[model samples]
Target: MPRHPTFTLRPLHAALCILLAGPAGAQTLPDVVVSANRQEQQSFDAPASIHAVGQDAIEAAGPRVNLSESLNRVPGITVLNRQNYAQDLQLSIRGSGARSPFGIRGARLIVDGIPATMPDGQGQASTISLPSAQRIEVLRGPLAQLYGNSAGGVVQVFTADGPERPELRMSVDAGPDGLSRYGLQAAGQSGAVNYVVDVSDFQTDGWRENSAAERQHLNAKLRWDASEQTRVTVVANVFDQPVSGDPVGLTRGQMEDDPRQAVANATLYHAGKDVAQRQLGLVLDHRLGADASVMARVYAGQRDLDNRLSIPLFVQTAPTASGGVVRLDRQYSGVGLRYSRRLPAGDGQVLFSLGLDHERMGEHRQGYINNLGVQGDLKRDEQDSVHSTGVYAQADWAINEDWSALAGLRANRVAFRVKDAFITGDNPDDSGTASFSATNPVLGITRHLSADTNLYANIGRGFETPTFTELAYRADGSGPNLGLGSASSTHAELGLKTRLTEQQRLDVALFNIASRNEIVVASSSGGRTVYANAGRTRRSGVEVTHSAQWTPEWRSLLALSTLKAQFAEAFTSSGGAVVAAGNRIPGILDRTLFAELAWQPRAWAGFTGALELVHRGSMVVNDLNEDRTDAVTLFNLRLGWQQTVGAWTLRETLRVDNLTDRAYVGSVIVNDGNKRYFEPAPGRQWGLGLTATYRF
Candidate 1:
């Protein structure tokens, strides 16, 4: 199950004929609006595989950055930089998600419309804090099936509200390892009330060497208008952090010149890490009388984590170490309702949504003598409770004039409970457990030819359940287990959308997915732990994107994706054929490319210059093909400045990332016998920023 030889698409058709022979300039392009099928269209008439990241590209990408490195310059993303800022931050889209050990377990993270996943879906949303974002949409396969765990897709995030005028902003940044950042923002409007506020602070002394980091943040937004069809909104967020630890599974000459000396014989609780978070929200929007509209929302969140790890043993006479430390507390609550109507047939529309989610998790563990430590006086304690409910309906039929059709369906129900305590030999041991239900489904279609072309198709179903730390994880490490159930998925897609002129725009898709009883995590021989279903799996893909404006100040964007995953049957052990049936699926990557180019000139007054290119391919790090990874390319640069002084406005930016300082390894994790790895980029950096704003 290992093969290589099949490389020639004539350099991807000569890079798409030099990007379709550049320079057809001015074609007016700026309509980009999207809520991705939950309503709000015009992303060239959205049909799926959407992408957006406005707010001026997140202020030219800066300030306590690394939202997967600004989503890896978008385009069939696959960012994996476990450079550890308190570990766990690896992302994947298009190519069947989930690469565990914290951070995304079957993708789904929505903010603003809330649903940051966690109802035993193992949620941890990468400490999001993007300067109170104003946009960030990324929907891929399965068209996300209108949320509710549509298996790998959806990362909607939209913040920043309550401002129609009056504002103040501040930003400061410094880079190159000892990075520092500061930010502040304010907004105002009075009459029917409105306000927004933000604050940030960051510090780093990283790039290795005990790796240090500190963070603090606060965000708030509020709006009210009680008379014209009612409206109310409020949101608050807070975070605090401390981190110091890097060098995970090192080797490559210990990450070239001291990567904290490869954990320095481990200890310090095996490299300590800490985190804290909090959130609160409420939203209501009603206009229940003119064509109909209604919305409601509620949210609450909390999280705390501490970890210590260390392991390195080779007994016979010496060389020893042992580690384990964990402390976690998580709590979340949610409520939602949505309705929209405007139907009399023809130009018809109908939408409905309902949701409820609750979660409470607490776990504690201690067992150390190396691998970092702190969080003691506990041999294990656990408590978990989860509940979920969801309902949905959709329609947007316009069956005429280019035809259109969109249909949807959603259903979900999940429940779980667990309680445990232990302190063996010192007395005390107890347990309790439960599990309830799970279901999902969705569909879509669209067609238009002209007004810039279009065509689409979709099918969906998704689900995941099993948490309480994988049903009480324990493999001689003490206790917790009480049965488990829930894991399913099926997805399909087809697509094409075009604009091709007016500065170009294009999208293309073809997809397939399948899953069943696939829960994984196994090991045996004395220290044993298990949860296996591992049967049935398949994934297929193709994605393409292009954006151009070649003149009128020059602009360009390109994207490509291709994937293939398998394992429909066949599994053996005892050192042979561990996985068969068309192998290939383990951190899937067969090709990915992203390109960006920009130059705004006309006498450089409000200037801009940019260039970016990222490429990745060749991967297969497990399922017993020994292990492999190769193929990497990266480069980035940006320079900016803008102005408008009258109502006050100013901007500045400068960036450069890994211009060339490669020594790859982006992700890997092979249990028990260990085989870590993670660090594919970061080395060669530069940043500078400034911003100011005011209006009205």
Candidate 2:
């Protein structure tokens, strides 16, 4: 579980306002603050690439218990766990932007601000339940061009608002296949109104073999304050899952000799699968005074899925052949709207926004067979639709006191439609169409050489469009190639933020990205696979982070990342040789590393530990490199504890994954030549958890 990176919380809210303004009138650590560039500024004064993850370092890491695998260990991004719990999941951030086979395209997922993907980007998010979240922001390149047709970046989630007392929480967990989990939460306030609620449930018995799973979750929040410039907020969520579709793909020496036999579930296709989701949201924050303020939001969502497969006819010769069945169904809907404003020059601050979105999708299929008993039938239907509108504005100028600058622009208009029907042979029916419009831009710079140090630079541009199974999958008969366009990128970065004293702190970044057209999914004619628009690709990266508090009961954190992707021209297949140009752009993973350590000792006790390392390189499954795979490494561990008596409070955790049961293979798989690959990365697993809280 990874992919969910791009963070920025204004450096942990400037280190919690310098630990709550202590150290006698603290004044450094503040050149500009941020609300994700909607207003409030600083961070090289905004231009893009934001990243933040706090809430006490996400409760001291604890190997992130959900919430998209705790943002998939931050850093550029990559998260693909097609199996091993949480049924079928995938996410990518740089490479694999619009050629998704199943791995949500070009990222863009938000919570609180609503818009949980769904506009052909297809997003379910495993029913997000992060125990009252309070922080998680990641806005990549071009600041994601104000959330519209993302080209890979933007995952914002924020919950747990209005607090100063009243609280309650509970949790429990169990592990090792047959796992179990439960959770509950509550928040409070009265007079001016404020509230929060959450619930969760999870179960698993999977590791292949008819894969079993069960999940349920709900979240809610409300806030109101009629007087003093008015304010209103509301949010809701619901998710459910009941799955059992074991499509095991294994390789890597049979998963290093058995990762539960790499799942296939005793054949017969192993059927049964169901998934559901629902969401609702509303917001209005007014303060028509004090530098002006007005915010509005509306949202709606729904999703349903079903699958069943079974096949078996003449296996090991003909003993009177018999058996076959297939079924699938899917549906989705979405709506959204937004508006924002903020102005007050002088030291700097200016922001603006407008938005609208719509989405719809549907699919159906059926098949049957029973030889010896004689029976056969087949039917299929599909549909897709999407519409979008957007407008944006940004500014943050402070040409004094350490310089600052920022700029923004966004304009989008889109529409796409498709329909299809079939029944056996004789060219049943088909239909398709397409549309597009795009505009994205951004710029940035900041310098505040003192007060703890700061320096920044930025450049931006982004775009993406084309999904709905890449404009109606038709594969073998060609046709359905809607003059592909949209798929562009241009990004640059140079950064540094420091406080290297008083408990240490550091952040560094250097990035580069370039692209053009670049939308691939080859193999046409009879064998299927369409959607093209390739040529050009380049990516460069580096990130470093550090945190400290050596004494006072220890505290530590360290992170490192490096990446390189290439391919800038050269093509000719369809049996024509050629095909070359830097290569190596397949499942990106040059290196990654993470570390953690903690100890509180009093003030409610505390203890934490963690470690992670991964390096994946050497790809090329087909772009005509003739299959390739080699390069792997993995490790993980965690332990945690918390305490507090009186009103009640307790927490505990212990986890060990891989831990030496090594055997990896996770670089986003989807190359059905039948040699089956991708199935490793699960062994020697363990988990145990407990949590409780209360107050009034």
TM per prediction: 0.33, 0.32
lDDT of each: 0.66, 0.60
Clashes of each: 11, 14
- Regions of candidate 2 where Cα sits further than 4 Å from its true position: 1-87, 90-102, 105-142, 146-148, 151-209, 212-269, 272-377, 381-401, 408-430, 434-503, 506-546, 549-555, 558-595, 598-684, 687-696
Winning model by TM-score:
1
At residue 401, candidate 2 shows an lDDT of 70
- Note each model's CA RMSD in angstroms: 25.3, 24.2
Residue 534, candidate 1: Cα error in Å is 34
